[model samples]
Target: MDEQLHILTGSYALNALEGDERASFEQHALASEQTREEVRGLSAAAAMLAYGVEPVRPPQRVKDNVMAAIRNTRQVPAEAVVTDGAAGAAQRGHDGGVRPGAGADLRLGTGEGSGPEHGSAAGAGAGTDELGARRGRRSAGSGGSGRARPGGSRPGAVRALAAAAGVLLLAGAGLTGWALGQSTENNRLEQELAQAEQTQGAMLGILTSEDAKVATARMADGAVVSVAYAPSLNQGAVTAHGLPELPAGKTYELWLQHDDVMVPAGLMSGASAGSPMMALLEGQLSGATAVGITVEPAGGSPAPTTEPIMVQEL
Candidate 1:
């Protein structure tokens, strides 16, 4: 029982055992009448402490503000009554209040006598009554309901507008992100295309140089094959070591084959004796498929009379 009392004290301080320990404590509290009484006492003490520590201060102009609010509320109904003197008198009688007469009492600036000030007050009160009556009529037309229209906005309208604005802001951000991604991808593709164009131009320059030499061959039979030639346009030049030599009266004629038609490449003179030759082939080898050496007559043939002796796939 003493331990249970201690637990209740700790709970009051918000420092008791937690989780399973608190759950067990609660179960024990429910089972024992004494523990429940202790817990209740501790709870009451805690509440007293909480309330004591809370700050309490009167609102500024609270009296005037409250009075003003009450006055405003009553003004509507009071003005309605003043609109009809007979009705006003009847209402006063129902409330057991004395009705003021036009010549009841005389006081300076107090609408009691038949003076100008009294007349002025009467006129002003009558105006207030007429205004209130109009407001009462309007209220009655609206079914005497004090609540605003279902869809009508109040102070919470600002919050709704803010929420709508936030959604639009999020949508705008998403569109901006997508647009940036597409722009980056387009830039990357443009760079690749430019690089490809540059590479093509470099290849074209290499295929059309004049200081190019070519190896040539001809068939034993005189063939009317003309040879047009260009040098082998390697970065530096290809070392032709271990190449085979040409036979006598049958010079090697180089020919570039394009799309099933053989274009003439220049002739090769002298016996290479199986040694590599330092020669470049001529003409545009941009899109050539194969290079062929055919045998031709002395001084070279206009075309090939016989088949090629050697051919290299380019």
Candidate 2:
């Protein structure tokens, strides 16, 4: 048997192995009967450790918080699962399984008690046949009936049950925490999605409004430009459709011409087919008669350096 395989056996019993390691372990167990028996023995010992553990009482508000969170998360109402609080306490011989004030009379075995020797002795007549007899003797040693002993089967069984219950409670607490985290994340994402949808609707409404229209123009260089106008804002956005990219240090600048005075709009570094660029007007353009574009310096110049590369009558 590979040593790594044996190490995984413990993790497997605890349900900790994941992905390929877990799959490989399952395959190995399926092929090896000896390994399967070892897995069973290890599982039983693990169970004993899990059950013989002293109950850990979470905070007083933990249970209430968990239940409250569950209620908030579930969309539908259902019957509540009843917990036998009193019986659970009686069986564990405590007021609360894990409360600070709860009395714990159970003696938990550790070390060798958790070994495979103790768990896999098998049947009634083995070298450890005296183990059950020892339990009986210890029960007799206690000042009660031959039934109430520390290491007896009944006490061990009860401890196991209590341990299992404690494990379940802890597991539930973990699940609740994870669920709350996921709920918070989901709520955040939903809020973001809703905001995005609202923004998209508003943008769509703006795009289709009567004040907005598409305009097309041809440049002297044989490039075509398409622009979307927002008359209410006295602004228009343009994109060069199939315009050749300018060399480095060259840029496209926008202009608005009213009367004969040309006003600088804005500068763009590059243009791509159908890619929109914002063209912010320098001043009120309600009376503007024409829009034009010129190739200018990187940051743009106060006046045109050359004849208009593209011009469109509004």
Candidate 3:
């Protein structure tokens, strides 16, 4: 936990942390005034460096319209351009997107097969031709159509569209991340819940079984090892009380003896003088007639490397 606290300083200034992580960092920061001030100063510096953009003066009213559009705003009826059947049909077609020949005049740069982008002057001429064709059609048709000329959208409208696109992209990324996090959390909780249910059911079966047998042994440290075994279920519940906490990278492990061989049963750690720990030995005692507990390295040894501190005969 202390190591995790030390690592939070790197991300504290970015405002990028998710829930629980942010709260934990905040608590650590509050506890250490120096840490709090350091984070604050770093946050201010990061803000400036990340946003040291040069000033850009966009067209008048671009800010207002772009913000309003991003907020899903509505303007007065008088300000809206009315659209009837033909205009609506055009909108639906655009909404449906890129019908083969109706897409944008996209030009590829060099390296495209059999082609490179034309010079700026040629490109300008092409734009002019496209715009002129659009104007000619609008003039020839009924005035009820609200279609604008090619590239004729207002500067404010263009800004609004760009802002909308950016908002949508960010929103999509956020939703995808949230969904992945939810899936991971759900899987973790399900595993924990299943383990808890399994342990509880195994304990209940041992306690209620009519053919259950119990044995106990006294350790050199004065701790007691107890085992409740059920022959019918081939399972046992083991408990140790008054265990002394071992040094770092050391733990206690249990084993079940089948004839001359002793197989791993489970591992126990962290229990102290007053606290007790329980473990379930499912099917480990199926063909075994006795159990043993021994000291081993952390994560438990593959097989016991020392004599048993406690042993119980069935």
Clash number by candidate, in order: 33, 0, 0
Please identify which of the two predictions, 1 or 2, would achieve the higher lDDT against the true structure: 2
What is the model-wide C-alpha lDDT for candidate 2? 0.42
In order of appearance, the predictions have TM-scores of 0.24, 0.33, 0.38
lDDT of 2 by residue, 10-123 (tens): 676555664345434533433343554455445555555665778989998988876654432311001010121211333344424433312122111223344333332111
What TM-score would you give candidate 3 relative to the actual structure? 0.38
lDDT of 1 by residue, 1-314 (tens): 44743455445223334423432343333234455444333433333443456686778788767664443332223323322221233246555463532111111221234232111111111111122232122222333343221222221111111211111111111111112232244544434333222221211112112222322333345322212222222211112233355556766666777878887766654222643332224344657777776777766777777797666656
The top-ranked prediction according to lDDT is: 3
Residues 49-136 of candidate 3: C-alpha lDDT, one tens digit per residue? 5346887899869887666433432211211111211112234545454232211111111123522211111111111112222111
Better of 2 and 3 by TM-score: 3
Model 2 weakest 10-residue run by lDDT: 75-84
Q: Which stretches of candidate 3 lie over 4 Å from their true place?
A: 1-194, 270-274
List ranges where model 2 is wrong by over 4 Å: 1-206, 219-222, 271-282
Clash pairs, candidate 2, are none
lDDT of each: 0.35, 0.42, 0.45
In candidate 1, how many clashes are counted? Answer: 33
